[model samples]
Target: MAPSNQLEVPQKSRVTVVGSGNWGSVAAKLIAFNTLHINSFHDEVRMWVFEETLPSGENLSDVINRTNENVKYLPGIKLPKNVVADPDIEHAVRDANMLVFVTPHQFMEGICKRLVGKIREDAVAISLIKGMEVKREGPCMISSLISEILGISCCVLMGANIANEIAVEKFSEATVGYRENKEIAEKWVQLFNTPYFMVSAVQDVEGVELCGTLKNVVALAAGFVDGLEMGNNTKAAIMRIGLREMKALSKLLFPSVKDNTFFESCGVADLITTCLGGRNRRCADAFARNGGKRSFDELEAEMLQGQKLQGVSTAKEVYEVLSHRGWLELFPLFTTVHEICSGRLAPSAIVEYTEHSARLPLLESPVHLN
Candidate 1:
């Protein structure tokens, strides 16, 4: 009662989403809804748009602001009114203390370059993008790239998150992976958790992120099985084998990865959903049906509207890493997916390596398949 002059007001965190594609729009909707109800955040959510001219000749950001919907990427879904779309990348994130990155992996390096020295010094980032950048040195995870380029600590959120279903309020779960800060991880959990969307946090950043990245390669294999007219049993075998390789490769690259992380929503669950019905799987199916005559680029243009496919690109990236390190034989499904995608091997080759992979010993060491 005697400290009336010492009153202090806590600062609320402002959030900006750094991409405006399908998943990005859904993420902004979720964050905007929570910010309005949560006291620790500002109600306004700024979403950065890679501006495009729609078929109606209206600028995407302008239309999003006017209609409260992403008329191009996420049509029919109503974005919250407070979710403002801004075309200027720097301006969208300039004042925000929390950044959510959901862009394609191929474009992230350029985005980070443009954002260098532009974001808040104290800002924290969370990557919802699930792919890696292969460099001459090695593979770089999205979260690591953000942290390295932006000078901020970055975390990752991943799961069996099919954006369209979640946009409609279907129940789903996600896992947030943090480095050393439990408090920061919990904050992300609180921001994304909703009645229909359950969120949890785990300490294995690499494990969670790799699960999300590598599963797309496996999904391509699953799609091959689908296109080849393989029954459910064969698809199940591919998924099981793919999961094994996912766990093996994750631990091989980052020995600190925990085994229990494989049981999380980001692990087996994500692998299952993506392999069954994800864009990668869908595209791979079409690629196989065409006897690999049509390239993935052609199929992508026909399908997916304007959205991007992470699997084919990720498979190539992973293959580069494996080829450079002489570990190609260690991951058969991953290797086959890249070979098939690049037209070196038929799509039917997805199953050719499975029997060999299944026979390999457990990957207790780099020489075994534990």
Candidate 2:
């Protein structure tokens, strides 16, 4: 049936990316292409730049707007014309109906606080961030923080997506985790899907998100093994143990999370990609090379340029949760990663301190979650 004249016209959706890092820039590139092709979405894509000066003393935002490239973070790749770089977060997201939050997870709370009562009432958000916030009460996922602070329904996108490879249009896959709204989730799928970038939607938000977050801790362990020059079999063993821990931790935290979600792009695929190529693995390799003499903060600054490794902080945060709940003894790998990162144990101990040495007596038993 045709709508009457009194019926309101649907408002076109405007897109804004509230970050300017490597992944953030790639995310803008992907969304810019989609918004222009989809009639329901506005042509302009606003990306919020934290506003830094380049080494040559040029304004980063101005350079991106003039050159159509994120000259500092994601150099050498051309961004779409519609992807406008804005320095002001408020102005960038002013008229935006679809906000993509991709900043480092640590800054999200402050960012959300600034967006309270400022964003569109109907705005929906999706987090491309892979880290989680651990409060004294418990852990808070980025999606939950956004929903609580902005009063918006938020979903999460995660997988084995590396920023540089995705920017060059390599084949990759991602998973969108939604709470309930299938329609909203499909809209996100449309906004992100590309020929080279495949996207899928799943109903298990916590499962997909934990897969993304917890994998960082595991990646750190993988890095330690690499630094130790352990053979392929040893690394494979670490990976297998890490995968079991990841699934067990997820199930213990959120029982509703499906077992099969671990088989999706956000699960095993992400774990493999991150372990092999992610910054955490790279830095962990370096940390091991130095014999843990230099602190992670110092190494991060020297090794990663300005980019932060999510695994180091994530391992610490996960440790906090495990300790608070008296579950540290149950999670041997996680506990060891934190201890090793904090310089308590040598890199080689990644193998020595197995579940056998921990307080758990069922180390030889089959993988089962209590």
Candidate 3:
């Protein structure tokens, strides 16, 4: 053995992506590329796959390892050869010092519980999941939940990201939201930034994450307009009203939320893109076209293969928070979106409720912090 006085080399950071859906796979590709080129990180990336058997009776993880493609979720795009797929969640994350959480919001609580004692104590996390969980006390952001449960600092990444487009190296921009550590945020930006995918970091975590969560609700309203075949003027009006409500609700919930955060790629740009072309909009369009008879569940399975729709569920979660706090009237566009989504109102009600409710003043009452 070497002498005790001899200096030991520092360990390079290892990364594990905890989910392997469409977005998760793309995130792995981006991180894998950066790690291979950057000296500070390990070149190999581990991706946790929720094993499913294909019709051909092959395990999803096996197929991914053999073909270097997620044929079930994201077909045709080859993940980097260094992005190894692991069927075991604990095994996937055990050795990594950086964890990327990209699973559905609803499943996050359970996932966090499973990871409590499994992850390295010094590991840092970033959430790409764009939703929230409503606990008995109040609404908890996914990053907050990860931090609280796993005893680690968690940041978030959100923007006008359409995963499939990013997978093809199309140009896009994303924002990294951090609570305090700017250095950690920059490291995350570096891991994700590329010539085609530009990334920037901001100090407002809640604002950025809330922007990502609330935009899906707005996208549903936009979809209703599209399904109704409304003209560009009407669609633009809907988008404007939705953005105002998003800002109002975010500020009212987290009084510390920055107004300028609404100008970032995670804010107005994400709202616009999700409204125009995201899966939430596409599925909501189908829900409206079917006269709201077909549930979002049926439409999601039919349209998305296996991907989850954030808008319908996010609308429900936001409705719970609004109704609990008696702020529904203040957020007319938000209220109407959830009402229409849950079958309490017809899809056509989006136009009437939003138009009438936009006239009311918002956040006039005391802000309730949860």
In order, the Cα lDDT scores of the candidates are 0.93, 0.90, 0.92
Candidate 1 on 183-285: residue-level lDDT in tens? Answer: 9999999899999999999999999999999999999999999999988998999999999989888888898899999899999999989987799999999
| Ten-residue stretch with the least lDDT total in model 3 | 361-370
Each model's Cα RMSD: 1.9, 2.7, 1.6
lDDT for 97 (candidate 2): 92
**What does candidate 2 score in Cα RMSD to the true structure?**
2.7
The TM-score values for the models, in the order shown, are 0.97, 0.95, 0.97
Order of candidates by TM-score, top first? Answer: 1, 3, 2
Clashes of 3: 0
Residue 13 in model 2: lDDT: 90
- Give stretches of model 2 more than 4 Å off: 1-9, 355-370
How does candidate 2 fare on TM-score?
0.95
lDDT of 2: 0.90
Candidate maximizing TM-score: 1
The 10 consecutive residues of candidate 2 with the worst lDDT sum are: 357-366
